[model samples]
Target: MTVADLVVDCLEAEGVEYVFGLPGEELEDLLFALEDSSVTFVPTRHEQGAAFMANVHGRLTGEAGVCLATLGPGATNLITGVADAQLDKAPLVAITGQGGRERLHKESHQRLDVVHAFEPLVKWNAQLSDPAATTETVRKAFKVAEHEKPGATHVEVPEDVAGEAVDGEPLADHGPVARPAPDDEALASAVETLEGAERPLVLAGNGAVRTNAASALRSFVDATGMPVVATYMGKGAISDRDERSLMTLDSGPESAAGGAVERADCVLAIGYDIAEHDPSGWNPGGEKTVVHVDAEPAEVYADYTPEVELLADPTAALDRLADSIDSQWDAWCVDAHETVYEHATRTPDPGDTVSVSNTLPILREAMADSDVLVSDVGSHKLAIAREFPTYEPGRCVISNGLASMGIAVPGGLAADLALEDDVVVATGDGGFLMNAAELETATRLGCSFTVVVYRDGEYGVVAEHQEQHRGESVGVRFDNPDLVAFAESFGVDATRAESLDEFGDAVDATESDELSLIEVVLSDPPDRRA
Candidate 1:
């Protein structure tokens, strides 16, 4: 068998169902092999879109989502999404094709040092030079990408090498390696710290959701009677409807949840990664005692020094903590609870046209319990993170760490494929146009989803920031095309909603058989800063 055949065999052994990419000359051999394999190669309009799709797929499945690209420019285009997965902690395997090793030593056409280019972005990376190393390289890439603190990994195979015959065999599949339990001394110290505090709060981050610690997190809160708050990406780690949930922690210095942080003497940060939530904004004083629980040690930061760290699987650690702790705190943060309610019930101000405050709740209610909502990076992202109620951990997908725009459309498509759930893309006008061509991809795949475009005729987040910081907005506005017609060109039904009632009707009337777009004509000023 050829080396490319061996590579495909390894991917099959890893149980990879989809490979997203755009075709190129260097990838001919690999593409030919993929045609004969069971894994489907999803062709996208651009490598960026393909990378985004693969990135979100990994985020949802906890497996290494694979994306393929040719050498040089194609490889470079995959960098942003790959780096995003690296920083955001998503498991992804990025495969790129290179020129022959002999030509790579000289000034060869379409050849560059892909390994070093990817070194800064991946947890591990390798460029295959020998045909015999195919199976081992592929196996190592998948293993490292799916390891604890999961992130991106890269494997590059040259054109000549891919076409060469090889006798490499696929690695034997084995059951998952068992995770170690938390140390007894550390667990005891964490419990002691919690027991000593009168007002303790639980801070959930993206790691909590990635580790599937929702049930354990809920039990921990119930047993201790402590309130829980989530970071932007951490939303839905506990049901927002739960009384113990303080919705989500607002970003910036003065936040609605700041009162809870101020009143609490101790913080139990479970599966909390610093990337999703910046500690400086919330913990300016750096005085609160912290108990860090996750699959790995806490990231050392001046504002986030842990008094005790429980390094182990979050689910296992929480289960052990629940079994060891027997405590009750009757005193709750009444003010924080009130703040959460106020935010949850907030409505648009009188005479304000097209407001998220009035629109998101209707959309949330209309979606099924199993449906997924993906948020693009924009002002709406901040609002959704705070106002959207998630019943389950994977239900709400938001890009909080890298905060990349244009993720919603492709991300929703990926979520639909991975979860087999009806998906919704909530994006702003600026973000919509960033990768609007992906609409064709969605249509080609026949994946049904709803795209809600908040039409504000400007970069709303940047405009809001400029207005707040400089007392005036400039150079951030732009004219948009007739979004409805634009969407219609792609053979998708599109409509414009000018009022709350109209938007609600649009949401209610949406079907899952075809792609739909709802353009909300929003011209109102930004809501008060969080």
Candidate 2:
């Protein structure tokens, strides 16, 4: 067997179903091996799109989504998406093809230090110089990528090494590393803090969903009656319909959910990664006592020093804490959530164009509770993060870590493939155009999902920031072609919706077996700062 064959075998053993990437000369051998295996190779329009596909696939399935690229630019294109996975705590395995070892030692065409370049973007990375070590290397990549606090991992195979003869089988699957429970003293301290605080709150993050701690979290909330405020990526950790759920916390300190954070004397942050939403934004005063619970210890920050650190599996910690806690506080933050809901569902003024606020409720009504909504980074992302109501864990996926634009199109495709659920991609015009070519990729693969583009002809987020600071927006505005036509050109069904009713009808008309795009022209950029 060739080393390339062994790599594919390892991937199959890891239960990897799809490998998203573009064809490259250096990847010839690996591509050939994938073709012969049961693993499906999805050729994307760009390496960036491929990585984003893997990013979302990992985030949704809790498995290491795989993506492949060639040397130099092909590997570099995967940076943003891989870094996004790293920061978002999504499990992903990135494979890159390298030039021959002889050529890599010196300056050569399309040759770069891919392993070195990927160091900061992944939890673990290595180049395969020894053909005999293929099984161990491939197995380690999956293990590290899917470990607790999951992120990206990289494996670079030289073109020569990939085709070299090898004799070995794939490594045995040992399953995930088992996490330990919280210690006695730490659990006792956390319970005491919760009991003493008059207005304690729960701040859930992506880790809560990733660790499958939602059920335990809900039970803890039930026992304590604590209001849970989720970070953007933390949405669906607790059902939005629950009275105890205060919805998502926005970036600014003045947000509706921020009021709860400001009022709480104790904050029980469950699986809350400081990367998601910095503690400085929510706890600017640094007066609240924090009870940190996660698989990893708390990141040291002036504003987020945890008084009680439960460094254990969030699920186990939460279950123990729920059992130990004695008092149940009233759900004091429900009123704040009411304001958030009202603001999110508010109708737009009578106009020719539709607004995100008006379109969200319609889209939510059209989608089932199990459906997934992938959001690209832009002004629309801010609105969706705060306003969109998600009922199930991993259902509302947003790129809040690297917060990279252009993730929605490819991310929606991955969500559809991984979850087999109705998917809707929410993106602004700027983000939509970044990976628009992937619409063709989606169409070719017979993907069934809807891309909703909020057309404002500008980078809405940057423009909003500029407007807020300088009183005028500059350099962020641009022109765009008819988005409906752009999407239709990709062999996808397209429509333009000018009002909420029309948008709802367009969403309803979308066929479940084909790709669809809805372009909503906005009269003004969404005021996400609110």
Candidate 3:
């Protein structure tokens, strides 16, 4: 068997269903091998889109989503999405084609050091230099990528090496790496702290969702009666529908969820990553006693020193805590929840111009609880983080880490491929156009998902920040082509929604088997500042 064939075999053994990327001459052998294997190769319009597709696929399915790219420009283009996966803690295995080892001693055309370039963006990375070690190398890549604190891993295959003859089988199937249980002392200390605190709260982050601790988290909340505040990436760890859920924590101290955090004497931070929302934002004084529980140890920060660290599987830690902890509730928790509820339920003022506040609710109403919403980074992202009510884990995908703007379109495509439920992408006009070429990719792949573009004719987030800090916005405004016509150019169904009613009708009218786009014109940014 060829080295390319062996790589494909390893992927199939790892249960990889799809590989996303733009084909190149360097990847010719690998692509042909994938065509013959059970794993389908998805050709994207851009390498970044391919990486994003793999990123979301990994986030949703806990498996290491695979992506391929040629060396030089192709590898460089994959950097942002791969870095997004790393920072967001999504499992992804990235393969890049490299020039032959013969030309490594001297400078050559399109021969950048891809392995070195990817070092900062991956948990582990290596070149496939020895064909004899192909099986072990591939297995190690998948293992490291899928391990606790999952992130991206890289395997670079030289063009000449990919065509080399190999005669080995993939490593024996070893299921998922088992996570360690919480220590007795740590567990006891956590229980003691929670039982003693008058105001204890749970702060769920992306790790909670990544570790599948949502069910255990709910049970713990049910037993403890403590309010839960989720980070943007942690939405639906405890359903927003739950009375104990204080919704997502916004940027400032005045946010309703932030208020809950401020009032919390003890915070049971389950699978919480400091990167999601910096501890200083919520625990400004570093006074709140933190009980950190996750598969990995807590990151060291001045504002986030854990009183007790339960370095174990989040699911197991939560399950144990649920059984040991006593009910702990405070009136302030209820007040915070009520405040969030009021804000979410508040009706928008009737007007001709559509706003994010009104637009989101209509889309939420039209979507099922199980349906997925991939939010692109922009002003709309902040609105979604604050106002959107997610009901299930992995149902609301946000790129808080790295927080790249172009993720939504390709991310929606990946979500649709990985999930049976409906997928929706919420992007601002700026983010929409970043990867808009992928609309054609989705169309060609027969992906049935909806893309909702919030048209404000500017980089709304940057403008809002500029306005907030400088009292005026500049360098953010731009004109756009007719978005409806732009989307329709890709042969996708498109419509323009001038009002909330029209947007709701458009959302309701989305077909199950067709890719569609809805352009919602917004005259003003939603008031999300706390």
What TM-score would every model get versus the actual structure?
A: 0.96, 0.97, 0.97
RMSD of each: 2.6, 2.4, 2.5
Report clashes for each candidate as comma-separated counts.
0, 0, 0
Rank candidates by lDDT, best first: 3, 2, 1
Model 1 compared with the native: what TM-score? 0.96
Candidate 2: minimum summed lDDT over ten consecutive residues — where?
344-353
Q: List residue ranges in candidate 2 displaced over 4 A.
A: 251-254, 345-353, 525-530
> lDDT tens string, model 2, 455-524?
8888877776788897877788788998888888888899998777788789889987789999987876
Q: Which tens-of-lDDT digit does each residue in 1-530 have in candidate 3? A: 99999999999999999999988888889999999999999888999999999999999999989999999999999999999999999999999998889997789999999899999889999999999999999999999998998999999999899999999999976888899998999899998988888888899999889899999998888877888898999998998878888888762225877777777798889888888888898887678899999887788788999999999999999889888876657444777787786677656555645788767767787789999999999988998889888899989999998999899999999999999999999999999899999998898889999999999888877877877897777778777899999988899999998887788789889997789999998876543332
Error of 1 at 439 (Å): 0.9
Runs of candidate 3 with Cα error greater than 4 angstroms are 251-254, 330-332, 347-349, 524-530
Clashing pairs in 1: none
Q: Considering summed lDDT, which 10 consecutive residues are worst modelled in model 3?
A: 521-530
